[model samples]
Target: MQAQDDFLKRIEKLNEIGIALSSEKDTNRLLETILLGAKELTNADAGTLYSATEDGQLKFEIIRTDSLGIAMGGTTGVPINFPTLPLYKNDQPNLQMIAAYAAIKGETVNVPDAYEAEGFDFSGTRAFDQKTGYRSQSFLTVPLKNHENDLIGVLQLINAKNLGDNQIRAFTIEDQQLAESLASQAAIALTNQRLINDLKKLFEAFIQAIANAIDDKSPYTGGHCHRVPVLAEMLADAASRSDYGELAAFKLTEEQMYELKIAAWLHDCGKVTTPTEVVDKATKLETIFDRVHLVDHRFEVLKRDAKIAMLEAKLAAMQGGDAEHAAQLEAEYNDKIAQLDDDREFIRTANIGGEFMSDEHQERVRAIAKHAYVNEQGEDAPFLSDDEVYNLNIARGTITKEEREIINHHVVATIKMLSAIPFPNHLKCVPEIAGNHHETLIGTGYPNGLTKDQMSVQARIMAIADVFEALTARDRPYKEGKTLSQALKILGFMKKDQHVDADLFQVFIDDKVFLRYAEEYLDPKQIDDVDPAKIPGYDVGA
Candidate 1:
């Protein structure tokens, strides 16, 4: 009855360990759990877990020696200094080493005593025992085989201890059975975990590839796709670590953090649909190419026409012997040239869009458009096309209203694209988080126009990151990257305008996420000192 009860209890523990293994998500923790669970069930004093490597070797993954209190790898941060044991040597399977032999043959090798064991090299184990003044005995080497019958790793436990007397002994047949069962469960768990991780990595790579395609599509946004994720992760991390106020209770699980990061990476994936010409427009009169050059040529034509008329009038005056009229004609021609030069300079300045285009500037553009020039077909036409005047008169930045609309449409397209993807449960919020970066606390933002109350904190964190990256990015086409203080001030104003989450912004400032990211990605020259107290919409006390 006593023996039966002991076996039943061990069976129960085995079931518990199986459940734990299957449920475990993190690879490192899962490995540790498998090794530790196997050791506990078998009552082993020391053990090592070796994962199969692509280079046909058994790599040390986790090592624990209970009696000697030695531990390395698996979140201990102490690296395994031991070299990998080759599974193949001399163009064949390495059967001399017991662990390598187990992995290669896909069989369990239970040696009651290593010193007394035959048919395998125990020199390395003997040396380890000699160096540490420890006795190595009773090895239960189990091969972790996946569903496909392939050996994924080897689990070897050393020095099994008697549960009653605490004396080292050979592993019981029950112990071997339990370890094999656990190894089977662990293999399944590990294989599933690796598959999940590989899929995730492939998915992330696909997302980044899409982002790169978009970034490469527009030369102006060269690194925006890459940098935003770094910034978004930083701010979200800062928000997660905040210990007070609205975000005091806010936190991100490892999965949630990964979701946010993936969201940030795919945030602009919709920009693929955006026209490269509009996205790359650096000057107001830019399209497939800058039309400012065309305008420049037209001004030259006007000047040449003026010179021709002046020379004709002078010749006629000279032939009629009107010397004074000829002299006045020369003065008028010089003044006309001066006026034309001024107009051309104004138009050139207008083409390079910056700041606000005031009413006066718009009027001047319209008036200049009325000037006549010979068209390409040798017919007279307006010096500036009406469309060119409209583009040149853009109130701010380079793109006009229609082009701006086209640009804004990208966020909508991004949402559409991301929503179409069937992300897993943990990642279902990816579309919301990625697409809502353009949204505001108020309803003024684009696409869905989701207000702060309707959006997740992750999305709000994204807004702060996106805006801040834009402000600090040195690679934008419209403007120079702002100084640290200038960026903070602008972000502060955004906070005041209800564009960003005030709580996250305060955390962003208080935690100095900006400084952390700036040190890494910002231009060294743009890294000016920031005085947080003067930030426009920030609450220093809060």
Candidate 2:
């Protein structure tokens, strides 16, 4: 009856160890638990765990000698200096070493005494015992096979002890069975962990690939997709460190940080659907090529026509013997050609977009469009089409309203694409965070036009990151990158317009997150001095 109870108690401990192994997330701690549990169940004086490598070898993972007060490897932080035990020797299975032999043969090896063991190499064990002045005896090596019946590693316990007298003894049959069961549980747990880690790596790699593809789509916006994530993480880190205001109560765990990183990487994923020509539109006349050259060709044709007319008048005057009339025609031709050259230069300048194009400049483009020229069909047509004039006279930027809408559609596509994915519980917020980067605080931004009340702090942080990166980015197509003070001035105006989170922006400035990002990504010239007092809508005292 007592023997049966002892067996049940050992089984109960095995059950508990199995639960512990399944719950352990850290690889080192899980390995330590497996070896330590085996030692406790068997009352072993020492033990060593070996993991199987892909190259047919047993790598030493953990070693513990309780009686000698030695613990190396695993969670102990002490690396095992011993060489790996080879499972093969000279291209043949090396079953001489017990741990390697067990892993190769997929069996539990029990030796009552290592010195007297037959058909195996015990020379190393004898040498180890001699150096440490410790007896090496009664070995039990069990192979850890997963659910697929494939050996993953070997668990070897040395010098089992009898609890009654505390004397070292051979491992009993019951001790062998308990260790085998625990080994099975540990193997499955480790396998699950490896699968989870591999999936995580694959997912992160896919996200980065998308970002790279977007960057590659346009040379003008080369690093915008990559830099936004860096800035978002920086601001998030700053907000996490804040001790007052709305952000003070917020914090992120390791898992949440990874979730945020995925969102940032994929924030502009929808840009894949955007037309490359529009995304790379450097000038108003840009399509397949800048159409400004077409206008220049027309101006040259007009100049040639002026010269022809003047030569014809000179010929008529010579026939009539009227030299003064020919001279007047020459003067008019020269003035007309010079005026055409000036108009051509004006059109050329208008084609280039700027931050602030004057009303006068727009009026000049319209007037140029009204002038007539003969087309290839011999029909009279406006020198510049209405469409050409409209594009050239784009009020403040290179893109038109329709093109801006097309660019903004990327956010809508991002939400649609991400919403279709079945993210795990921890990453459920990824779609919202990524989709809201284009949203603003006052419900004026698109495609959802979410207000501050609808958006999370994470989404707001992404918005600021996206905007700030655009302001300081040197790789944009439409305009030159702003200096630090210039960028801050614009951001301050944005704050006044309620385009970003007020409290978060304050935390961003107070924490000096802008300067930190500037040092890493901005050019030396774009790092000009900034005065907080001069920045519009910024309260330095706040």
Candidate No. with top TM-score: 1
Q: Which ten residues in a row have the lowest lDDT in candidate 2?
A: 368-377
**Tens digits of per-residue lDDT for model 2 on 202-270?**
998898999999999999888988898899899888889887578878898878877888999999999
Total clashes in model 1, counting residue pairs 3 or more apart in sequence or in different chains:
0
Give per-model TM-scores. 0.97, 0.91
Most lDDT-accurate candidate: 1
- Give the Cα error of residue 84 in candidate 2, in Å: 3.4
The whole-model lDDT of each prediction reads: 0.91, 0.89
lDDT of 1 by residue, 1-542 (tens): 99889889989999999999889888999999999999999999999999998888899999999999999999798999899999988899899999999998888999999999999999999999999999999999999989999778999999999889979899999999999999999999999999988998898889889989988887788889899999889988888889757898999999899999999999998888888888989898887788888888888888898999999999999999999999999999899889888998998888888768899999999999988788779998988888998998998988888898999999999999988998989999999999999899889998877788899999998888889888887777778889899999989999999999999999889998999999999889989888888998888887
Window of ten residues with lowest summed lDDT in model 1 = 470-479
User: Which regions in candidate 2 have their CA more than 4 angstroms from the true location?
Assistant: 1-7, 67-72, 80-82, 126-135, 162-167, 314-335, 530-534, 537-542
Query: What C-alpha RMSD separates each model from the true structure?
Result: 1.5, 2.7
User: TM-score of model 1 relative to the true fold?
Assistant: 0.97
